[model samples]
Target: MPEVLIEAVQPGSPDTGAVAHYGDPVREQRTLEGAAGLVDRSHRGIIAIPGEDRLSWLHSLTTQHLTDLRPGEGSELLVLSPHGHVEHHAVLTDDGTTTWLDTEPGTAPALLDFLNRMRFLMRVEPADVTADWALLSLVGPEARIPGIELDPPKVAPVPGAKFASADVAPRPTTVYSTAPLPGGGWARRMAYGYDLLVPRSRVAAVADELAVPWAGIWAFEALRVAARRPRYRLETDHRTIPAEVGWTADAVHLDKGCYRGQETIARVHNLGRPPRRLVLLHLDGVSTDELPAPGTAVSTADGRDVGFVGTAVRHHELGMIALAIVKRNVGDDEQLRVGVSAAAIDIP
Candidate 1:
């Protein structure tokens, strides 16, 4: 498990869990409510691909349309095993000679090691930039910061909002536009390119000046669940494939040329159905006093193992809701029991 580092933003304020380096709960809530806030995601992996063959080298390894990615364009992609298991899902962006890969924190080292093993005398070089660059997430309504634009025009924008990036004080910055949610909620992230390290003493001052919110892992987990995003460790594992997690819409590119797991992805897309499907579960008659453990069996009224719960939360408005991976043939409106505790969950 990744250890969350807690940093205090204000004197006597609650210690915040910085998933990367700084966590702010107030900022996290603002992020969910569409308020402009910043989050430090620097702890997440940031890999730089430099040198002449950077683009070509990366294109050959990941499953996305990277060959034609423009200087300021970003796309999500997956690194897959030859047998079709998902190795890692990454956000790829290029800034001239170097391409930046933003991935989960703990997963970066292993990925870098794998890429290094496959270097094979290529001109490309891969290096970890987490320590050098600070990742700031600007999200919510009215979150635009001066000079950024969203990429796809069709995606809805929050009122008085646009996405942009800026240089980390005293450093160069690269900004790329991205899609915002419908009805005025969106997220924009900027990576401050630093030539020299910023002192840790001024970290909180920088964060405070930027208005970045402190978010804990719990708050982030809730936001991801609300967005219906599948996480790496909780909802996925070695046996999981990109298609099984419904990541094709964002991660995999079907028309792209041969890459690891391309055959399996194509075959599954064209000829086979996903054995299990992801679903939202709303628990009924449960209070703060009683909560079902994750991985507890979910069975049909007739007692068949339909699925198991993955994550659950107590919503301010919706009571308790969960995410579950269940057998595909299960009816959308079916009522199922979680564990032998008699707790019923309605498929939504």
Candidate 2:
């Protein structure tokens, strides 16, 4: 069924573009977890890197080991500050000729600038292609769409890892599956899905043709929070590091050689723990109308601030919930508060 047009609302984050829902968020989320639901992600940015030296050059700069990356394989990586702060995150796939980067909206400019400045003598050329390309996400139990051949590769589990490697299938539209949460297994509760890259002109037509229901960012955020998936913008700040939110398993390759932030990552992983860790907050009495906004202060029961809320929503089944990064010492069983409402923390 086609989505009836509705007023766009902010999705609780400043970086996130307006468009909270496409009619019904709760039902849309149900569709996403069952069969499939098409989400319009045109606001997402795309960058194309074309050249023989692309992979090697990228491998030298980011947290992932990309030199051996196979065409059509999906993987995520992070660009961090010298102090190990997460500056950028991208889910990328390489075709034989060009490597495509899918990044959050408004991130392409900075990423493109960084890439361009570092191109010293490499053959690679990176360009923003958001104008020519758009993203449509088909999320649910199976990544099925009509008239497309999608064979998601079998992903081997990484025992006791924090995140799993992303898997993908080769296709013209370029489909990549999200890695299942908690690293090494699959669960119906996790919104494991695929992202499809289509031409800017065809996104609307493609969304219209999909037989499944349509979802908005609101539904996506709720599922993401429930899965404890940390978004680039919402879950990070000036001092954020990959270890804080379990991004190391999926985005960082410990065996890889030097990168800008490798020193800090190595030190933290080997010698100590990150100052903060990500957690899922069950908002005790929060209703849809009373959902805590992102950046709301999270404090101990006695009123000592520890962290801030990242994303919060009234889930269809889980009532109200959120994702937050708190001090590493915060006890798992401790009572927490988001503003005036009490919240219970679940370490993800």
Candidate 3:
């Protein structure tokens, strides 16, 4: 397991945990809904693939159309085993010389090893870049900074800037090179030479300058729940497939040439259906005061197991909602009990 780091950003907020090495959970949660807030994700893995054969080498290994990725363009992708089980989900981009693979912590080393072992005679080279760069994620409506343009799943760089759009998830994400800061700071190395990430001791100063409030993991969890996005540990595992989670819509390109798991993915898409489907669950008479644990089972009235909750949250406006992977036959209007300990919930 990766080492978890937790920091307190505000004066009176409770300490929260993170898988990444740095971040202030209190401020992150608060900044999720209204203003922009930054979260330190430096602990996530980053692998740089360099050489002219970079695109071709990667395109042959993973899902998604990577051969045509422009220097500033980005996309969400998945790496799967020959049997079609997900190895990792990642956001990949190129700075012209090298392709960057940003994914969950503890995944980079294995990915790099696999690439190295498979590089028969390819002119590509893979190197870990996590330590050399800092990752700062901005959320909220106002978090949009001046020099960046929102392109949904792409972040366009301002003209004449060294910054490139860092693609994260299936949504827009940007990454800036930070080897050029005046004091050798990571933020200065960004393509735009602007400080998008702040030092741990100076996080507040950066937040104030950006006019965004600090946010916490709780708020992020709520926002992700509202959006129906799946998290790695909470909603997915080795058993999960792209079709079952709805990630196949953006993560995998059906028309792309063969890759390791192409056969299985194709078979599943054309001849087989996912055993379960992801759905939104709206709890009845539940409030923020009573938060249910993820993975709580959902059963039919007679106690037949139908599904399990993936993620749950107490939204300010929506009360309690959850994302669940239920049997395909489950009806949307069906009412089900949430495990043996929790209350009943209805599919929304």
The number of the candidate with the highest lDDT is: 2
TM-score computed on alpha carbons, candidate 3: 0.73
Backbone clashes for every candidate come to 12, 0, 21
The residue pairs in collision within model 2 are none
Q: In the order shown, what is each candidate's alpha-carbon RMSD?
A: 9.9, 6.5, 8.6
Better of 1 and 2 by TM-score: 2
Tens-place lDDT per residue, model 1, 79-110, is 89999888887776665666777777667888
The candidate with the higher lDDT, 1 or 3, is 3
Per residue, candidate 3 scores C-alpha lDDT tens digits across 1-348 of 133344433222122334322244443444566665555455567777889998877878888767777665556678888888778787665656777777766778888888899899999989887666555556666555544443444333212212122322322223333222222222322221123332445544545555654444456666677777765545675677777887676577665668988887777776557777787777764333454566778888878888888776666667677888788888776768675334444434
Q: Ten-residue segment with the worst summed lDDT in candidate 2?
A: 181-190
For all predicted structures, in order, the TM-scores are 0.74, 0.85, 0.73
TM-score of 2: 0.85
lDDT by residue for model 2 (1-348), tens: 344332334433553553567677888888887768877777888999999999999989998877877665667789999989999999887766788888988899999999999999999989998888777677888656554454563333322323232332111122243332121111111126667777766666666666677787778777888888898878888899998998876677765668998988877876557999999989888433487777889999899999999888878988889899899999999999998889998754
Q: What are the runs in model 3 whose C-alpha is more than 4 Å off?
A: 1-31, 154-211, 284-290, 341-348
Candidate 2 deviant stretches above 4 angstroms: 1-8, 15-18, 147-191, 286-289
Alpha-carbon shift of residue 266 in model 2 (angstroms) = 1.2
